[model samples]
Target: MLKKLYLLPLCLIFFVPLIVCEKILILPDHLKNFWIAGVNFDYFSYYKSKVLLILVLFSLISLLYRLRKDEISIKSSKLYIPLFVYLFFIIMSTIFSKYKDISLWGFPDRYEGAMVLFSYIIIFFVFALVPKIKDTQIILNSFLISSFLIGVISMLQFFNLDFIKSYIVGKLHIFQLQYLGKVYIKFNPGPRYVYATLYNSNYVGSFMAISFIVTFILYVLNNEKKRIIYGILSVIMFFSLIACHSRAGILGVMVAVIFFAVYKYKEILKNFKFVAPILIIYLLVYVFINTLSSSYIGNKIESLFVDINKTITNSTNNNLRDVKIYNNAVCLNFDKATLNFVFDNEKIFATDENNKRVSFKFDSNKNEFLFENPTYSQLKYFINNYNNMPVLILNNGYDNLNLIKTKEGFKILSFSGKINNINPVDKIDVKGKEKLGSGRVYIWSRSIPLIKNTLFLGYGPDTYALYFPQYDYIGKFLFLGTPSILVDKPHNMYLQNAINIGVIGTLAFLIFILCYLIFSFKAINTLKDSSLSTISISIFFALIAYLVAGVFNDSVVYVAPLFWALGGLNFKILNN
Candidate 1:
């Protein structure tokens, strides 16, 4: 029974990547984010619910053995300290959380991070209980098999069979592009990227990067014949990452390669005699691949900075550059209206169609308009005239101008921008969508002050939506063009932590990262054994790459198998 239970995790591991495409009905519909698993027999809804069921089973196991105290091991001790610290901070923050419920149990009360942490605890405790390297091999093998399958399936999706997307969506996916009665799995962006059951290409890129590093490390562990197989796997993972077209992931791979070279310098440098021939062969191979490909892969690689500025503008009906320009114009008009309010002693109360008031006044003493400052006059001399329109429009579109009078105030017009015909107070109904996808730019801009306000304790988990308006929802006038009227998660994880948990969580989180780096570095440094050294080096560099990528984007979090795998690997080294 114990062996069977141990094998259970491995069993699920094989199915993790495959289960994402299966059909299942969800209870609340919003539980879908965590449900974006790969192809599987079970529907996403079933898998999500099953995670809870598995948690219950594990909880029972913990309870049944709660009275039976097992001897502690070196690995468990090292792992538990950090785990406990994370939990302690989370619990303490929750008590003081403006969003107490989410802080304790996750936003939907599912405890995704806690579940991940629990899984780590289970693996560590089981390792201590069993004290077997064979168990570690089981988990690693499962991951290797799943990653191989995922790579193959992702390649198939790039072929655009339409069957894959159809089978995955289970229903008619209107969001997916349909061409010639077939659902095309390419974004409208130039050179169209494929997002296989994954929500974004970046996710695919990150997954591939980690998989490549693991495979490379495994290749290092293998004997001659097995090394060839792992070598092929590395190539496949690298190709898949390139196909994803994630610049950050590509940069991460380069970082890993550089780290590998520096760490393995002596071993590689020993073959200095054949270096010139190897370099010549590599150049020839690169040229051959570039010439053979029909896709502009060579050109794209050469010109990484594809001017997406034209992309946004060309898509919009108006001369305005794109959705960004439109959004900024709205913000611009709102800011101007706010100034009108202050000067005339009129209170500005602009809202969306929903009648939710959107404007707020900043502290008058510190946050004054630029025009009110003496510097504005000097700066204005460089340009024809300085207008306080939303920054979005002036930068992207809104070249021509006119003015009109409304019941509330004077309305400015620009021929190059879309006309604002609808009442500014009417809400445009932008709820429950990816508010912005240009990545962390807007979040960094808006979340700074919120972080400062909660300098010590933060507003609490999931309180950004409630408090964002209090700071800078600035109506439709200022034209900052932030996506949603009701702002939520601050996009960046670091900012989100500072805003939700306050100074303590930020410090603790940073400390956790610091400990991870220091321990991994120490392990790598102490490596006398070749296999141990390789594994430690790979794991350390992979963590570095993951952290670098994660700073700009959200990650797999605790529920992700990668998290558990990494945690288990670190614990093994600490114990060893």
Candidate 2:
């Protein structure tokens, strides 16, 4: 039974969700600022890597044994050529990487090293090459079953009854960590970011998207007793997707559904009745959730077009009133008048709303301008995140004033807008739009430049953090709201590949994936009403959905294994 079910162990990947781990960097004197203390937890990547490594080894041996007995060779698959090219580049990158040890095994927190990359590739080759149609069918069923449980847990988390969290599940939960020789556990504080087993809410969004696509495809294909089961699963996964509030996942859903419609147009048209009710239910649920959550769905969509610089500028506009920036100065417009305050060349020049320059006494001892205009005395100000975010507080001094001056500098904290005096070219850059897509733009901008180094080969797999300008303090503080925050992943899969394995390798990876997609696409017409065809089409779109979501999400241990496994299945089906 174990021999027949040799592939069943691959399904264990569904149980391993990803969490950001911190590791104490044992570095040289220069790289001391890398981290204060690392986030190493035994629950995630360490265990995940171990499991994947075992799977890789087992799969490799099994494939080789099968090859010895059959005409099948790994080289026979068209995928091998491109994948080999990608692997070659990754090897070169690993060898040439400054942090060779890290390149081989991955960074301390992230375990997506060269070895792990091979694990992913082997997992792909195993399912794609080794699985028979009958065996693949069982694996697909396992996926749906696992997804049902993931949906249930996510639903529980959404409703604030997360029983699987560390506090309740002991050490089995993903958030358990050991830092500084002490157990540092991440507990759900309350009904906030309901990540479920995926650890990050964004990952949950991406996971649900794949699940939803598969469930939808499977449900649509079945005109039998199992149809209702898959329909319910679709709804569950859809709800989970929306609950996670990941806009990228939503984008993926849109792209996949469009392609799904194109592929299954005839089936959808014939079974319009079956599809209608489910879609309506989805619409109703989406509407209800959005209504309850202050129309965040609408806001999130609308924010994509809105200028982030203006948003930041307007954050404290109520406090500062209408501000018009002049040359090293700003004109504050009010209901009755305006105050023109100039700070050019470290000198204070104040003009009242009456269009007359107010004679302000400079108290050099106290570092404050004393304006004598019968309306105010001393111009005192500071900065804080009062109710909003990084906002400047300026007024008369006192608790009643709210602008009481402390020893702290009147720091801007970090201003993302134009201190550049609004030139014609409009060079606001990514920092100005850091809040866009929840800072995806900032991450992308930073990651794009490193693509140059990867024109031939990358820095190395999972060495993104080591190369990223974590010391861009102003950018970090302004965009990420903290200078000390760690950027572990590029939050984009393609960018991740380009940075880790190099652009040439990324192209190879693209070719490998695109070959599968194109093959599946072309094979759809040849497919009849058989269960194998149904499973094939379903897994095909699931892969599409997962890749689409990868635009705004990096590949993580939680989701990548299942993707690779299923993607391999598609490769097997489409090629055969």
Candidate 3:
């Protein structure tokens, strides 16, 4: 029973990824900038945290008893020094954080706070320090089984066969909470376009980026009968990943395949029989993608081979050339009205649907638009002449438009006559980008300026959202189609750590990961045992795939724990 402690982390990798539910949350006031007051539907992180805490509690008690009895020994101590340094910075950052409550437990939606970070450490250590576990195969199999199921469900969802979206699922999935005034939220399986358990299609893509290659490599490494099963699962995972229509995920898969090929070129040359069948299956999938009954998966796959820009446009829709927002203004050129905006010398010129020209007066002192002799019944309006994106259209009765251009951007007063944070569509200087990753360009440009202030100690764990320029209403409106969405995550994992844990802590984490990668390569090259070599190399390539995906996706709770679990397994294989 005592030796069965390893099963705890297995549960995290298996059950946690499969779980999704709508749970209620009471959000703090400061978070009201985006999160609704005392209401949320946490489909990803809530249950994962519950499982994590339970595992951590049990794992800690067992670890303490073993340490007292001198039953375990951690090898390669120098590799872990940076990990401890990182842990120190995490604690310090949390201690000095302004939003300590949020720093400790994390936000309701993400749940990636100091506590979760601490749990990750314990999870990593459980696999790293545990002596000579015989059931490591079970760990990989558990993840394989879990990912296969996710692939099946995602495939079903892409074809609109998801039972989770049915009425029966809603009636069956209700729970009673105390003091929440009968809080009930519907189970949203995200978009119908192949979003599985993860909340967003982008996150689903990231999750598959990690799992797909691991499953594929397992196919390459296993025996004949087992390899066939893994090969089929690998094909399913690849199809589901394509169904997600996430460009970042596809890029990560490409990187992972390139790295794995180079890493094991010699072995591939030695074992052509083992590698040929999977390659054939892969070619078949690539050729017949259109036959798959799904949403835009066929188009996305074809775009990769044909027109890349179309895929980029479909993926994010924030095409720089065709974007709805531009420098200090929203662009109305792409709208159905086909109206154009020209701001000249503080004068507003609007061409109506009937092509009638109307002029509006701008009062600098009062910060209001004054329309004179309006010939058109409907006219588009911007916050100011300098930045013109059509957010509001005034009726023929003239204008009550209170528009002001602030140093940051533009602000418009609410209809209630009270000053609100209602900023219109505005963007900084992003010129001629004109494609899908342009949205990344918008956020990255804004997020980089904020890093200068957080070089020493960051805002705190999971605190990236608080400092981000959520009032960049124009950027949000153009890229995301709504200013109400919070810029809670920095998408890039490196930027997230730099903002949340400071650049120093990020450097420490980098050092730790670098050391692990170096060690993994050394182990694989020098590994004498056939089975051990496969395990180490598979884990290495999988981690590489995930880190590549992290360039575009944030380390969200739904997918990141599995990466950490695989990290632990690498240590186990190397040290043992």
Candidate 4:
């Protein structure tokens, strides 16, 4: 029973990836809107939370069973001190939070509340306590197999072979096929970015990025026959990572690769004959894949420069010039009567048989627009200027409109007459870059002011959303386009930590990571001659990759567990 209980975590490991499709699981109507601690619990979070609870329970049971038998004794380590300190700070932040519900249970959209954080800590402790070599092997192998399956699915999705995706979606009745379908329509005539079992393409990229590194480490540690297998898996993951079209993932992988090469220079030199051929083959395959999808991949890569330029220019000037133009343009609204008067000779305005104004409401679900009697020029102008304008002219008054492209023409997804509550569209920058990540520069700039008062204790855990609106400089201007948009996360995990738990908590967390790095680096240097040293080195660089990627993405349900689990594994290996 004790042994069986210890293996339960391996089951948890397998189900982690399945969370992507878990939404498909059918739940009763009443259960669908289930609430836990005042938070609306979705099926995905419920399933994951249950699994974690069971795992923690079994781990405790196993520990108690072992203690009774006098077979094993619990040991204390200083490595856990910082983790405890971090947890203490997190609890304090949660207690002092203005939005206690959000801090404790998280937002409905992202359920990484106190419960999830505690589960992560529990998982870390489970791995650290049960660091048996066989268990470690089981966990690592499970990760590789799951990631390979995910990569294959993503590849199939990319190639438009929807059999697997359709079957899975069918099984998960609630899963929205349109979420994936809409990506193709949104970026028509371009390669469809595959998200696989994850929520988004960037997430898939991050998963594959780490998997590629792990496979490389496996290839290094294995025999020649096993090397061939690992090599093939690595190639598949590499292509999958690129196919995700995540700039941060790509940059992170490159950084990790460079770090690995520099750290293992001598080993690489020694194995140059064996490594050179593989490197050449990989390069050739990468080039072939890039050529096949050059248009899609090339455009994504080029956008990095556009993003950088937008950031740089925004730093110097506020980019308020375009905002002023947009405001002035939107404020000059021409009503139906006014439009009819302006085009009195032309039959542009729609009217009823009684000559009354015909009211129109944009259907959010559909992707086509029908003009009652619009001229070609008027229709074209509306389509062209729709996204830039804060509010568009309607029969009643100026209303918000989102012009989305369709096979027929541009259609409005949203239309509302109330200007005060308009869902503002993302504005184009002075350099013509549209939707520059919700004006991240402006958001970050605003975050600085928020941290001024909450320097030490922070606003509280998961309270960034609560405080974000108050200091949102760009949000006020852009609210006309996306009034309902939630600036919940800073998009930078470092900033997220600073705002969530303050400087002390953030430092405690950073110090814990720093200590792990120090110990792992020491282990790598000390065990330089060991066959498994490559694993240590690989994990170190992989963590670095994830850290760099975290600068662009906050820690989320999909990736954070894997990081913490691996960190635990690293600590265990170092201690042993």
User: Is 1 or 3 the stronger prediction by lDDT?
Assistant: 3
Best of the candidates, TM-score: 3
Clashes of each: 26, 7, 6, 8
Give the alpha-carbon lDDT of every model. 0.47, 0.69, 0.69, 0.60
TM-score of each: 0.62, 0.76, 0.79, 0.72
RMSD in angstroms, all models? 12.1, 7.8, 7.3, 9.4
Give per-residue CA lDDT, model 2, range 252-301, as digits (tens).
Answer: 88889998899789999998999999999999978876786678766765
lDDT tens per residue, model 3, 1-576:
756664654555555767776566667787654543356656568887777767766766766666777887656578888999888888988999999987888866888899988878877887676535566777777778888888998888977887656732554354424425554444555554677777778888888887888878877776547777877888998887877777778888899889888877776766678788778877776555545534255666554554345444443321223323233542343323434344443544655446566466766574445656332213434343323422332222333333344454435543333344553433345443322363676687678878888898888999888888876644554455444467788789988989888999999999999999988888777777766677777778888888888887998777887788779877888777
Candidate scoring better on lDDT of 1 and 2: 2
TM-score for candidate 2, residues paired by index = 0.76
Superposition error at 310 for model 4 (Å): 6.4
After superposition, the stretches of candidate 2 with alpha carbons farther than 4 Å from their true spots are 18-34, 71-75, 168-192, 291-294, 301-432
Model 2 score (lDDT)? 0.69
Angstrom error at residue 272, model 3: 3.3
Candidate 4's TM-score reads 0.72
CA deviation > 4 Å runs, candidate 1: 1-4, 10-18, 21-82, 98-131, 162-164, 168-170, 173-192, 220-222, 270-406, 409-439, 453-491, 525-529, 557-560
List the lowest-lDDT window of 10 residues for candidate 4: 332-341
lDDT of 4 by residue, 1-576 (tens): 566556566446545755642332333342232222222314334455455556656765765666687755557877689889878878888888876777776655456776667767766776666646446666666667877888887787777764545554454343235445432111111245577756567777677778887786566555457778888888888778877787777777878888888887777777676678777877876676678785667678677777777657744322212221121122111212111211222122334334455444334344223444432112212322333432222221222234333333323343232223223333223442234653565566556666766667877766677676532222433422443355767777888888887878788888888888887887777764354565666667888888877777777666677777776666656666
- Lowest-scoring 10 consecutive residues by lDDT in candidate 1? 375-384
